[model samples]
Target: MKIPRVVVGMSGGVDSSVSAFLLKKRGFDVIGLHMVNWDAQEEGTSQCPRSKDESDAKSVCDRLKIPFYTVNFVKQYWNDVFLRFLENYKMGRTTVPDIDCNRSIKFDIFHKIAQEKFGADFIATGHYATTSFGDFQQNRNDSQEIRLYSCADPLKDQTFFLCTVSQEQLKRAIFPLGSLQKTEVKRIAEKEGFHAVATKPESMGICFVGKRKRFAEFLDEYIEPKPGKIVLSNGKTVGNHKGVHHFTIGKRINGQYLEERSHLGYFVSRIDAENGDVVACEGSHHPDLYATRFRIQSPDWIPIRNPLEELPDSEILCRIQRTHPPVPCTVEKCETSRFLSVIPRIPLRATAPGQMCVFYTTKNECLGGGEIVEIQDTLV
Candidate 1:
């Protein structure tokens, strides 16, 4: 019998290092593949982060006695993920680029390269997610539809970023760290003498931002500034903004041009791109900052069939942010098949266009999600 060959995406991080170690210990043939998604030159940084990452990944592979290789997806990432990210910011909408990077690059392009080039039987990652097929795909069934589930560590659950992944992609996915907590992963790495990985701080937010002075400043290099007015709900102009791109819904406004003064600082309630007006509301908990109902573009359901069609008007749970616990929501078909209407049992704050509304079953299964294209009704 041929031992299954599994290719693991090693980022020199503790989680991935442990993933490869576990797979190899299980008697499967393991290979380490590192992806270079961003070019350091583009950011004008003297130190290239990818160089250190590649070195660390290779070191892990050497320690494990496995082969290691690096693949460059810099171009693909720039086109598929980064460009779309800039477009969203330019349009004054907050977007998550990590979702697109997972869907288009890691699972899609990486899968193709793994199979076509390396003859990999399966590909694995350190993502804190699990599937119905099991974390290691030990119980994979070709006929049965696979479902994504939140990892054991709810705080680190990445199902939100993976909501866009298709069924086919989930089929071959292996998440070794799904059942383990971050502390446990680090402990395992430490025991194995992988101290560098175990002690390395986890990277957060957008990867390409990389040691930038400020997020807004990093964005300014690419986006041309368009001055806009900050106003109240009653059409009262309160302040001026360099651009709508710098602000996200529900985030507090910081500027000197505000003519209106309140004990509670102003927060963005809306971004009117056409009129160049960023609507603001006093207080973080202002009614205008919350939305109970919204319309989303058609969802990319993980299951083979759309659940809404299977059970019309069924209760579901949804969340916009990965860290937030899923809230109960009801779904309805819009007049046009292109959209779906969602109403959460509780009001959702900072719901904005370009943000993904990830849905989950009552049992915590990730049912997939759709990008929120419109916010139909607010708490006003």
Candidate 2:
């Protein structure tokens, strides 16, 4: 009998290492595909060196006795994910590149390559999210639909990063680390003699940019800094800032210019890109820092169907950031079907524009999400 072929995205990390091991152990014809999304040669930095990761991935594949291939997606990533990320920053919105990377590169492009080119039945990743299949719906031509669920490790659940993935993409995707805890994954790697990556530190911040340089410094290379005035909510000019694009909503401002107000702990309330000014509030709990209602754009509902009509009658939970706890909110359909009005039960701090607002069922099923287009100020 021929074993089904599976392609696993090896990121030179512990999770992916264990995923490849588990898939091979299950008697599947497993292959490792390492993606070179960022060109570290251009950046000329030892930080996040693509060559290092490629070497590590190759080492892991060799140890597991599996075939490994390196695929460069730098051009695709630049056009699809990186360009949009820069545009969002230039427009003064907090952007989530990880979400875009997963949707465009990992699932869409990589999944296509795995099936069409590599003759693989499934494409797997180290994502901490699980997939479930339901009965075939007769209405949709008797086709099964994929549903996304939170991982067993609540603290490491990554469903939020995958909210934009379509049903077709989910159908061919696999997440081997979904049910395993982070600690257990490490143990599996060590027990299997893949000790090189067993204790590797997890990557953080932007995957492409790494932590070698400060975020502000990295942005300066791409976006010219436009110095602007920092103002209070009441229109009091407090000081000057390097640029409106340098700050995110709800982030605290700390510099010599804010030295006097520093003791008050001022956080960014808003960014006026047109006027080139940043509005700040006195404290984290300031009324100006919170919003009870906000609007989202281009929401991609899971199961590939609209749940708008049902939202008005039921409360759905919304998460503003990946690590944030989901907050109960009511969805109000807007005049435009593409846009949605979300009213939280309580005011939320730093409902940053350009960030995603993921909706979920009470049972932790990801319903979908959209970009925060507008924020309603209930305090006024």
lDDT of 2 by residue, 213-326 (tens): 677777777788788888987788888977777888888887655635656788888888888888888877778778888999969888666766555435578899999889
Number of the predicted model whose TM-score against the real structure is largest:
1
* CA lDDT for candidate 2: 0.83
Name the lDDT of candidate 1: 0.90
lDDT of 2 at 346: 73
Q: What is the per-residue lDDT of model 1 for residues 165-253, given as tens digits with 9 covering 90 to 100? A: 99888998899889999889889999998988888879887889887766888888889989989999899988897888888999988
Shift in Å, residue 212, candidate 1 = 1.8
State the C-alpha lDDT per candidate. 0.90, 0.83
Worst 10 residues of 2 by lDDT: 133-142
Residue pairs clashing in model 2 are none
Q: What's the CA error at residue 268 for candidate 2, in Å? A: 0.3
TM-score of 1: 0.97
